[model samples]
Target: MVGVMRSCLRSLLKLMNSIIGMVGTGMILYSLWMIRLWHQHLDGGGSISQIPWFIYTFLGLGISLCLITCSGHIAAETANGHCLSCYMVFVFLVVLLEAAVTADVFLNRNWEEDFPEDPTGRFEEFKKFVRSNFEMCKWIGSLIVAAQALSILLAMILRALGPDRGGYYDSDDDYTPARLPLLKPPVQQPPYAVDSHFKLKNDVWNTNR
Candidate 1:
């Protein structure tokens, strides 16, 4: 039972590590993609204002940094056998920072002055679309942060429970209760050599003879 529990805990830890690593790698890749896309847009005669460029650049850098931090945490956990709580906290911080940066980017967009050439036509339509999309992005960012926070909280709880509660890795010296022995079936005996009265009947017949 102890061995099984330990195996389960190890598997859980590995799964968590893999998930965080993938998320971090994805973040870095997405940031690079966004930067590349923006550059392409600029090259294609799209008049991207300096403000949006700055916002994109800032967000890209922030996401890159967060990914780096997450990677570092994962490496540290792998190398040092540290508690998963540390990684959880790191992830939580990264999520919170991401949320803040996203909010800032959306808020800093100047819809009123954007595309002034077409006063109530193209610019208004574009502004409405941007506003709606930005709001959606903001909600998405919030949900991501919320999910990260929940994961961190759960990791902390599992860490607190230790290996005894089927959490965390246990060392060889860890105390585990001995498993109870399995019950064995009762042994069957051959049928009695004869009925109880057989010996008495035999003795009476011998005396009569």
Candidate 2:
């Protein structure tokens, strides 16, 4: 019975992992599309639009990381044990960083204006702004960096707890057996028998007997 339960759990984990894989792949594709859009916007003198592009990039990255974390959770649950703490922490940190970036982008709309419009003054102003806002940008960047670092650490831990070093589901192995239940043979019943000595008490029955 315990083995059956374990087998069921493993099958469930594999299905969940497949779902996570699809989501991860979709996120990566979306990220690529966003990058292409950003480049087009830049070519069309839409540097201002890059803000949203950056936001989308960050969102895609966050989603990708989440899918990865989910995969890890499934693996851990099926093989070693379910420990979602690391995955949760990583997701929380990424969400916090994404929220901070979104807020910063909205709050500082004129941040792009900080850069000089004139080509000659562009480099100088860019440098000056970097120097002046170094502290603030550094803090924000640090938060994002910290979140990424934590996510990576969690992924590593999950991989270590996973069944394979590659940290992916074993596609080569037959999973159907894990999903099927054990069968038992049906009980047999005895055939009905009658006593030949028993007879009906009636006028027609007496003639027949």
Candidate 3:
């Protein structure tokens, strides 16, 4: 019954990892889109008035998350303890990075401060237009962070309650209580020797009678 439950848990964690992997891939694409837009709209006259570094950072986080998802699924399927441990650690870092990015994106929403040179009064218009997009991206980061946190939890749990392992080939042939060992057949006495001994004893008993 415990094995059955562990199997079910492995299935569920793999499914979640696959779904979150897709989400992480989408986030990477979104970060690329953000970079493109920042260049096309915010960069002008040899001055790039945008936060591209943060977007790049977010992209790295997304890639790490994707790797964790894929590796975690493989580890769960194989019941690999070391692989699972590494996955959990990397995912925890991803969660932290994503949470920081989300907080920075949502809290620091002052578009005018980011691009302070607005002579034609387009900053207000830009703010109104870009705020929604910013929020969307921020929510994406937040969601991924949440998912990664859950992935960490799942990985940790799997490390504890995963499955039976440690089976390996044995060279010796001693029986132990820890596990059943292969046994060899005992040596047999010759049938002729046994019959002669029994006949000699019978003749001695008959002569005495």
Question: Best by lDDT, which number?
Answer: 3
State in Å the error of residue 114, model 3.
9.3
The TM-scores, one per candidate, come to: 0.40, 0.35, 0.57
What does candidate 3's lDDT look like per residue over 1-209, in tens digits?
Answer: 66676687688778768767887797699778767766666456445544445567658867976887889888878767788898887777666665675567568976336533543333455457667688885676466566666667777777787555423435334335335433645577777555788889999999999
The lDDT-based order of candidates, best leading, equals: 3, 1, 2
Candidate 1 vs candidate 3, TM-score winner: 3
Local distance difference test scores for all models: 0.54, 0.53, 0.68
- Relative to the true structure, candidate 1 has a C-alpha RMSD (angstroms) of 13.7
**With candidate 3 superimposed using the best TM-score fit, by how many Å does residue 57's alpha carbon deviate from the native?**
3.9
**What is the per-residue lDDT of model 2 for residues 1-209, given as tens digits with 9 covering 90 to 100?**
54454455455444444444454566666566656765676687764622453436545774766565565555445454344454445456656766785576569976666433432233344458767998987785565455445544544444444443233655635665665554644465658655455533455587987
Q: Whose lDDT is higher: candidate 1's or candidate 3's? A: 3
- Model 1 TM-score? 0.40
lDDT of 1 by residue, 52-117 (tens): 443344456556545644654453333222546556656766777766755665686853443234
Most TM-score-accurate candidate? 3
Candidate 3 segments exceeding 4 Å error: 31-59, 105-130, 133-143, 165-185, 188-209
* Comparison by lDDT, 2 against 3, better one: 3
